[model samples]
Target: MKAVVITSPGGPDVLQLQQVNDPQIKDDEVLIKVAATAVNRADTNQRQGKYPPPKGASEHLGLECSGTIEAVGSRVSRWKIGDQVCALLSGGGYAEKVAVPAAQVFPVPDGISLTDAAAFPEVACTVWSTIFMTSRLSPGESLLVHGGSSGIGTFAIQIAKHLGIRVLITAGSEEKLAACRDLGADVCINYKSEDFVARVKEETDGKGVDVILDCLGASYFQRNLDSLNFDGRLFIIGLMGGAKAEMNLPTLFAKRLTVQAAGLRYRTPENKAAIVKEVEKNVWPAIAAGKVKPIVSKVFPFSVAAEAHKLIESSQHIGKILLVPS
Candidate 1:
């Protein structure tokens, strides 16, 4: 199999295409012939040696993929060869083939293209797991998402809207904020031009948001706390801005806030399966109905995986940047 391997700890240029042995299928796994994969922050981090794959995970640098099942393990019953599917991977998605637990895979809906399905798993699974599974965001409540035009943010905004939640988002620029508004964000704050804490308070009539989905980590930590309602759940999915910051203990105590940080890859197989189950039940229906959809910003050939990494690093895209494995 051919895969994008990290030649050394460095920039996107470190991602090298190399011939590697095909992953062997286990009794409960499926071997998929990958069609496409999406660039993620984790991938870039892993390429740069800042993040490494979890123990026993593939050393290849991809977090999610969509493909056709080429073979299934003897114990796998839910999927078979030739099934079009998209999956959240623990790692190793940037390859010609991957063997994953059957429980982590879900069928692509009818009429959805394979490449588009590739765009779904990472962001959809991330947002669904964080907001619905972790935070338990309910209808009519307000949810704020940072990096509003991002793959996860765009999906979060759409899902929050579809579920009847009030959505607020903050992006670096007005153009990105406008994109978030188009995706159904009720309030789009230009973090550059406006103070998000003030804008959020104004929009929610001083109540603040019920939840916050953040990836900015340290840079937004103080403001994120200030922008949340009492008992608000703040799920931090990345450390894009920085990793270290001081927190106001009094503010956290007074608000009774919940601050969480996690990555999908480090989750247990059971946890990932549970997230997949939730996505299959609640989010899949929305996808089938065209209510929630993957937002794809661009597509690059598999050979240009390095350039794709640059795009994600620049935060220039409105949604996912896809790599079609050829």
Candidate 2:
């Protein structure tokens, strides 16, 4: 088994490809021969020694992978050996093989290729959990997504559009805004040139958005509060800008807003299983029907995972980036 290991993380250059022991599968787990993995911000953070793996998780950097089941545990029944699947992992996705809890795997849709499926699990689960499960965003309501050209943002915009919600996205450039617009964003605000709160207000004709998927934590704290309508819910999935913004109590008191932050990897196995199940049942069908698909930015071999990390860290990719286990 080959995997990318971070030897005292500092930069992408620190990632070393090495042959390691294959993971041993538990009775409740499955052994997957990984085909591809997606590069995530979490992976870059881990490489830079910022984000550490959860307790008992593998030290490898990847968070999600698409692969074929080489073997199934005794307790597994829903799948068999050679079944194609994509899995959401707490870690260890940057490897040739991974032993994962069977509950965390989902069958790839018919139209989705094995490599492309690697991009689905993380963003799909993140968007579904934050927008539908946590925030409870409903049809006809307005939703704002920060980092609109990001992997999660692209999926969020498409999902919101499919659910009949008004979508607003914030990006730093015209190119990013245009990408988001093409993905069905109703309003795109160049955060570099315009105040998103004001633009959101003007677009909504005064009422703020009903829900916001925010990645810029402390920096957008006050603005996020101000951009919410009465009883609005804000779901924080990442703290990209920084994590110490001040809150306005008066604004919260007046609008009765709810603020919640969640990390998909920190969730319990059962919770992730539930999310995977739901995504399979509700989201996979749409993907099979060609109603939804992730926009792929690029693909790189597993040996050059560092290059993938560098690309994502540049924050210039318009969509998901895939890394094949070559």
Candidate 3:
């Protein structure tokens, strides 16, 4: 099996493709012949020595993948060999074959192709967990998403709209904002040229939003807090804007706000399995109904994963970027 390995902490140029031993499965895991996996911000961080895989996870870079089951473990009765599936992995989706716990693997949706299914697991779990499960965002409440054109943002917008929630998003360009609007975002603000806090206030008649799905992390921390209404929940998932900031306790107390941060890759297997189960039950039906769909901006062959990394770093794409292992 050929896998993309980081030679050292640096840029995309440091990634190297080399043949490695095939993975062996454990009793509750399955070995998949990977058809495709997608590049994510976490992968770029790992390549730059900023993020490392959780203890006991594969060193190769990839968080989610879609493929066929080449082999199944003894306890895996729900899925069998030859099943078409996609999985949320801790690592190793960059290779031709990877092993994952059976409970974390998902059957591809009824109408989606395998290549596109590769884009589903990570964003689906991330958005569903952060906005719905953790924050408890309900219908009739307003929600704001940072990085509106991103994989998570696009998916979040569609799901919220379908469930009768008003959505507001921030992006860098009009083109991306237009795309977001087409996906059902009720309001789009150009973060480069507008004050999002003020805009959000005007749009909501100064009541603020109930939940915020943020990826910018610390730099936008204060503004995010300001943009919240009473008893708002701030869910931070990415730190693209750096990670150091001072907190204002007075405002936090006044608004009765809740700030929570987490990463899916480092979760316990039981937790990941639970989230996967929720996505399969609550989200997959919407996908099968065409109310939501995978937003793939680009796909590169596994041999050219470095190119995929470069695109992810550039941050110029509208949605998910994928690498297919032929």
Best-performing candidate as measured by lDDT:
3
Point out the higher-scoring one by lDDT: 2 or 3.
3
Off by over 4 Å in 1: none
In order, what lDDT does every prediction score? 0.89, 0.90, 0.93
Give the lowest summed-lDDT range of ten residues in model 3: 301-310
| lDDT score, candidate 2 | 0.90
Clash pairs detected, candidate 2: 218-245
Q: What are the per-residue Cα lDDT tens digits for candidate 3 across 1-326?
A: 99988889998988888889999999999999999999999999999898999998998999999999999889889988899999999999999999999999999998999999999999999988888989999999999999989989899999999899999999999999999999999999999999999999999999899999999898999999999999999999988888998878888999999998988999999999999999999999999999998999999987788899888788789989999974
- Between which residue pairs do clashes occur in model 1? none
- 123: Cα error in model 3, Å: 0.5
Give the Cα error of residue 79 in candidate 3, in Å.
Answer: 0.9
Candidate with better TM-score, 1 vs 3? 3
TM-score of each: 0.97, 0.98, 0.99
